[model samples]
Every structure is written in C-alpha cells, then in structure tokens.
Target: MAGVGSEKVFENDKVIVWNFVLEPGEETPVHTHEHSYMWYAIEGAPLHIYDKDGADLGIFEVPTGAVYSLKCQDGYLEVLSEIGKGARVPATHKARNDGDRPYREVLVEYKDAMPAGGSV
Candidate 1:
C-alpha cells in the first residue's frame, strides 16, 4: 500500500516506526519490516492478514487493548520465541477492529521489518 496519511519515523537501530490510521476494510499491504515490531490494539479488533511464499494463510482478529510483541525470526519456530527472544522484537501482524468504533493502540516497542506490502 502506498503512503497515505502515514508517517515513517525511526527511533534507533534499523527500526522504522510506522504510525497511521487505517479505515474500515482499508489497510497496508503485507510488506516485510526491517525490524520486528510490537503492536497494541487500541480502538477495534483489526483484521490482520498473514502471507508466506506469496500465499494468504489466514486472518487474525486482534481485539482492542491487546498487546503483542514480535521479533522477525527465521521460519515459524522463531515466531514463537517471544519470551526467549526477550522483551520487544521484530514481527509482522495484521489487525482489524470489527467493533463500531475505530481501532487504535501504541506499539510499545518492537523491531521494524518490511511488511509484505499490499492487501490480498
């Protein structure tokens, strides 16, 4: 997805912080993040789409006020090492808030990697 009202500001390391508001049924494509990112659900349950090897796997519904951390590790196993990796890390996720209100949250801290880049 192209940059709309998006903002890409970096904190430190190779991490790029992405902050924006996605409209209903509107979202950013599956682009890989440079570093893993921590995502928090603020307003609604955002529908997150995951893809691997150019295939859409499934949709993950993240409710409001939910907090998650990611560290772009290799293969599927690395994705499970949340505690082992310790604290915040790079990760990819698609969130959708289905409630009547909009979804919002502050990704406490996580590595930023390139999101797949585009909707399914």
Candidate 2:
C-alpha cells in the first residue's frame, strides 16, 4: 500500500530515497518494503507499530541521528559480516506517531536486480 505521507525524494537505478514526516497523532498507511533499505533519523520521536488489522505491535524509540539497516524479514539485525543471503520479498508494516511532536526520517532503499519473477 502507498504510505499516507511518504514522498519519494530521489530515485535511480541503484537506490530510491523516501522522505517521511508524521505529525502528532499522524500515521502512515499500511505499506510494504520490498527491498533492503536503511533509514536516517532526523527528528527522533516515539512511534507505534501496528499490523494490517490495526493491532498494536509495539512502541519503538526513534533516536536522533540514528542509522538503521533493515533486512526484509528481520526488522533490524546486526550486520556482523558482509557476506550473507538476503530476503527476496521485503517486510510489511505500518507506523504511527505517538509522541507530541513530529517524526521525520529519510529512507534509502536499494533495488536488488528488480523482482525475479515479475513486478507485483
């Protein structure tokens, strides 16, 4: 699903960049990420994760200037080694701002040779 307020800032063959902004009590629509991506936190704030049915997943902290590399299946895994297999299909989730301030972050998604079978 398309994110409610996510904007594609830049895109190329190798990478696609997205800018996300959530105000107080704002939320992003149910969406899925189909590629390996990293995020840079701009305005850190409290956020809540939810499933497609709107079930509360958990609360997560968005630290300022924090960098996170997220795999498809695993949400946030430590990159101990550079050699490892990645997921073919990415993960899906929704996010909401539970804090009193705004939440901002930059996401850089790396396109991995396109979809194998075909584009969804």
Candidate 3:
C-alpha cells in the first residue's frame, strides 16, 4: 500500500483530527477507516475514487469549505461484536486529485461509543 498524505493533528477520548493535504495530480494510497468521520474542505477540487485494484470508482465535485460526513459500514453492534470476537475490519478506499489546484481538508474522526440505553 502507498502512503496517505495526512498528519494526525489531535486525538482524544472522543475524537481524532487529521490535517490532510494533496497537491494537484497527487493521490492517497489505499487506506482504511475504523471509525466514523467528517471532513471540512479547506480547498476543494475535483477528485476521483479508485478501488484497491486501481479501478476507477467515480469522480466527485468537491466545493471549497464544503463539509461531509461518512459512517462506517459496520454498525455499532457490529463493531462491538467484531472487537469482542477479536476481529478488525476497516472501510477501505483511495482518492486522487483530478483538479488543477491542491486539495486540503480537516478530517474529524469519532470514537466508538456505546448506545445511550446501554444496549444494541
């Protein structure tokens, strides 16, 4: 796998923050996310998503300062169950900058939490 061009700026019990940057024509290597996350685009541009096999998924128009959130495919119960059973799985994907300018964003990742009622 290649490397992701991002740095961990902060982390705490509740969340982890990352400072992501990518120059024009640059790309992020295949990466996985174990927790839910949202991103605020500092300098957005067109981007292309690709699979692990290098197949193009699609292109997206990212607007400057736009914010977006994504939930892990595994639900809360699934995550806990996987942990309990000693299984680790993460959502994987790769991204490429297709625009002329650099792309930057602040990514905030949420920590795992139990249900409010203490049950699934």
What number of clashing residue pairs does each candidate have, in the order they appear? 43, 0, 0
**Residue 38 error, candidate 3, Å:** 0.5
Residues 14-119 of candidate 2: C-alpha lDDT, one tens digit per residue:
8888898999898887787666667778988887877667887677777777766655545432221122223122255677898998888887776874334222
lDDT of each: 0.45, 0.66, 0.67
For candidate 3, which ten residues in a row score worst on lDDT? 76-85
Top candidate by lDDT: 3
Over 10-97, each residue of candidate 1 has an lDDT whose tens digit, in order, gives 4576444556566665655544444345555565454545443334444455666655555455522133223323332223433333
lDDT of 3 at 38: 63
lDDT of 3 by residue, 1-120 (tens): 114638888889988888889899988888876666667789998888776678776776778977765556563212222112322233576788999999999877778743243212
lDDT of 1 at 105: 52
**What is the C-alpha local distance difference test score of candidate 3?**
0.67
Residue 72 error for model 3, in Å? 0.8
Which model, 2 or 3, shows the larger lDDT? 3
Q: List candidate 1 stretches off by more than 4 Å.
A: 1-5, 14-16, 50-54, 75-101, 108-120
Ranking by lDDT: 3, 2, 1
Candidate 2 accuracy as lDDT: 0.66
Error of 2 at 47 (Å): 1.0
